[model samples]
Target: MNLETDLGGIKLADPVVMASGTFGYGFGYEGLIGPGDVGAIITKATTREPWAGNPPPRIAETPCGMLNAIGLENPGVEVFLSEYLPRLRKSGAVVIVNIAGRTFEEYVELASMIGTAKGVRGIELNISCPNVDMGGMQLGTSPDMVYKIVDSVKQVTHLPVMPKLSPNVTDIVEIAKAAESAGADAISMINTVQGMAVDIETKRPILGNVFGGLSGPAIKPIALRMVYQVYQAVDVPILGGGGIMSAKDAIEFLLVGAKAVSVGTGTFINPRLAMEIKAGIEDYMARHGHTGLHEIIGAAIL
Candidate 1:
C-alpha cells in the first residue's frame, strides 16, 4: 500500500511524524529509528535567544498523561543552524523546525532565518506554547493576532509555513480560519491543552512553572474534536496530532481528517513508537482494502 501523504508543500513517505519537542532534533532517536523510518521529524522548539527553561520540577506525571513546562529551551536560532541543523542533516531526517518567539518581530525574524536555512523541509510556528509567560499562547489566542503573525511571516519564508494552533481558545476553528486567510500552507492542531497538576501533600502546584501544557492520552479526545472541527472549516492540509499512543490512535486521527499525524509524548514511553505506528497503519490499510493513505485520510468524516 502507498502510505505517502503531504503536509502543504512538504510531502511525506508516510503519515507518521515525530512531533516537535518529543523528537529532539531527530538525532535523539538515531539509534532507535532511522531518518527514513517515518515521514518526518519536527525538531525541538527553537527561540530567537536561548531559554534557561522552567526551574526544577518542570515535569509532572498525571493519570494517563504528562505535563511539561520546558519553556521552549533551546540554543538560539544561530546555534541551531550552525550546530543542530548540520547534525540533523547528517542524520538524514526530513527536518521541520518548530519555532517560537517572544514578539511579533521575533516570529517574523525566526521564520525568515530558519526558512532560508539549509536542510529544512518546512516550518511549524509554535504560537500555542502555554508554558511561557509571554508571546506563545498570547499571540495565538486572538484571530486577529493569529492572522497578523502568519500573514507577516508568510512574506519572508519561502518554505511552507504551518501555524500550530492552541486548544485553549474558545473557538479554535476561528483561529484556524484566520491562519488560512493569512495564507498558511497548512494547520497543525491541538498543541497541548492548558492544564496543571498539584501536590496534595504540599498543597502546591507540581510544575515549576505553576502551569504547563498537558499532553498524552488525557488530552487525546480534546485534540480529536478540535482536529475534526478544523477539518470541516479549513481548506489547508491538517497535521492532526495529540495523545497518539499507538497505531490505533493515529488511525483515528486520519479518519477524522488529518492528512498526517505527529506522535509526541507517546515516544517517551517507546522511542520506536513511530515505526510501530507506521507498520500498524499499513496493516490497517491492507485489511481495510485501501491501496493508498489518501483513501483512508478522511474516510470516517460524515
Candidate 2:
C-alpha cells in the first residue's frame, strides 16, 4: 500500500530497500534505478580494511535460491568515505552503510568512522559475517555475542544502528532481544543461512569458499518467520531481507512486522526491481485502501 514508512529515525519514501552486498556502491546501478525511487540503498558489507574476498567460483544455484561466499569484499572505510560517499552525495538516496568486523574493537572503529562520515543516514552492524576460523556460523548463533557487538558499535556512533541477524541461529528471537537491549535502533534479518552445494563430478563443494550463505526465493519463508518472531520479541524496527523480490513478497514482510524490506538477489535478476516494487506497493496499498504501511505490520494470521 502507501509504502511510505519510517524506521527508527530514518524516513523512507517507500518500504522497498536494496540489500547490502547485492547493491554495490550506489553508482553501480546508477542508470538502472532512480536515486529517489526506493526507501534506502544499503551499500555492500564493508570491513575496516580492504578485502580481496574469497576465491572465484563463489556462487552456486540451489533449487530456488543461490549460495554465495563473497567474503564481504569492499574497498575499505577510508576509500568509501573519501571517494564513494562524494559520488553518492548526488544520488538523493538514504545511504545506510553496513559495517562488519572480526572483533569488538574493529566494530567500534568502523562505527566511529561512519559516525563522522557525511553522506550516510545510518549504520548497520553486520554481526553475522561467517568467521573463517569458527566455521562461519558461530558469531551469529549466540545471544551474548550479538549484544556485545551491537553495544560496541552503538557506543561509538550517534547514527541509528541496525544489527543484521543470522538465520542460522537456533533462537533468533533471543538474539533480537539482545540487540534491542544493546541499544540498536533497529534489526534486519535474516542474513543468508549457511549452506553448501556439491559438484557431482568433482565430488566437492561448488563454492570456492566451500560454505556460503543461501539466498533468493527459497529462503523467504524462513526469513518471514524470523521477522515475525523477532517483531514479537522487540519494539525496535525490523528490516526484512534474504529473498524478497516482488511487491507481494515485500508485502508479506510488512505483514510480518518488517518496517521495510530489502531486495538482494532480486536485483541481480532484474535491476529495475526497486522501481517496479515501489510502484507495485503503492498501487497495492491504494487498492487495498491502506493509507499507510504501518497498518500492515503483523497482519499475517497463523
Candidate 3:
C-alpha cells in the first residue's frame, strides 16, 4: 500500500506522525522503534528560553483520558539545537520542530532560527499550549492573533509552517481560516481540549495549575468533528489527532479529510503505537483494495 503523504510542502514516507510533546524530541523510544517506523517526528514544544514548567501534581488521570499542566517545560532552543538536533538528525527520521513563543517577535525569532537548522523538515507552530501563561492557548484563542503569529512566522521561515489550532474556541473554523489567510502552509487540529479535575475529598483541584488540557479517548469524537469542519473551511492540509488510540481512529481522521494523523496520548499507553497504527492502516488498505492514501482521504465528504 502507498502510505506516503504530504503536509503542505513537506512529504512523508507515511501519514502516521508522533504528536509533539508526547514523543519527547523523537529519540526517547529509539530503543523500541526505529526512525523509519513513522512518517516524521515532532519534537516537544520548545520556547525562546528554557522553561521551569508547572509544579508537582502536573498530571492527573481521568475517566478515559488525562489532564496535564506540564507547562511546556523544555531546555530552550539553544540547547535543543546544540544537543537534541544532532541526535534527532542522526536518527534519520524527518524532523518537524514544534515551537512556542511568548510574543510575535519571539515566534518570528524561533522560526528564523529553525529555518536554517540542518535536518529540520518543517515547523509546527504551537499556538495552543494550554499549560503556560504567556503563550500556548492564550495566543490561539483569538483569530486575529492566530493570523498575526502565523503571518509573522511565515515571514522568517521557508519551512512549512503548521499552526496547531485550539479546540477551546468560539469557532474553530474561523481560527483555521485566519491561519490559512496568513500564509500557513498547513494546520494541525484539535490541540487538547481545556479541562480540569477536582478532588472531592479535599475540595480542591487535582492539577498544579488548577486547569489543564485533556487528551485521550474522551476527546476523540470532538476532535473528529473539528477536523471535519476545518477541512471544509480551509484549503490547506491538516494534521489531525485527539484520543487516537488505534488504526480505526486514525482512519476516521483520514476519511474526514486529515492528510496525516498524529498519535499523542496513545503513545503513553503503548510506546510502539505509532508503528502499530501504521501497520494497521496498511493492512486496512490492502483489505479494502485501496492503493494510495488519497483514495480514502476525505472519501466521506460526499
Q: After superposition, how far is residue 8 of candidate 2 from its true place, in Å?
A: 1.1
TM-score of 2: 0.96
Best by lDDT: 3
Which digits, one per residue and each the tens of the lDDT, describe model 2 over residues 1-302?
35567778888988888899887876756577866877898889878899889997989989999999998888898898888888777777899999888777778899998899888899987887755545555566788888888887878888999988988878899999998998989898988988999999999889999989899999999999889888888999999877888989988998888999999999899999988987887888788888888767788836
Q: Tell me model 2's lDDT, rounded to 2 decimals.
A: 0.85
lDDT of 1 by residue, 1-302 (tens): 78989999889998899899988877755578888898998989999998888887889898999899988889899999999999889877788989988777888999999988889999999987432445245779989988998999999999999999989899999999999999999999879888898899999998888999999999999999998899999999999999999999999999999999999999999999999999999999899899998888777889
TM-score of 3: 0.97
User: What are the clashing pairs of model 2?
Assistant: 1-285
Relative to the true structure, how large is the alpha-carbon lDDT of every model? 0.90, 0.85, 0.91
Question: Higher TM-score: candidate 2 or 3?
Answer: 3
TM-score of every prediction relative to native: 0.97, 0.96, 0.97
Write the number of the candidate with greater lDDT, choosing between 2 and 3. 3
Model 3 collision count: 0
Model 1 CA deviation exceeding 4 Å by range: 129-137
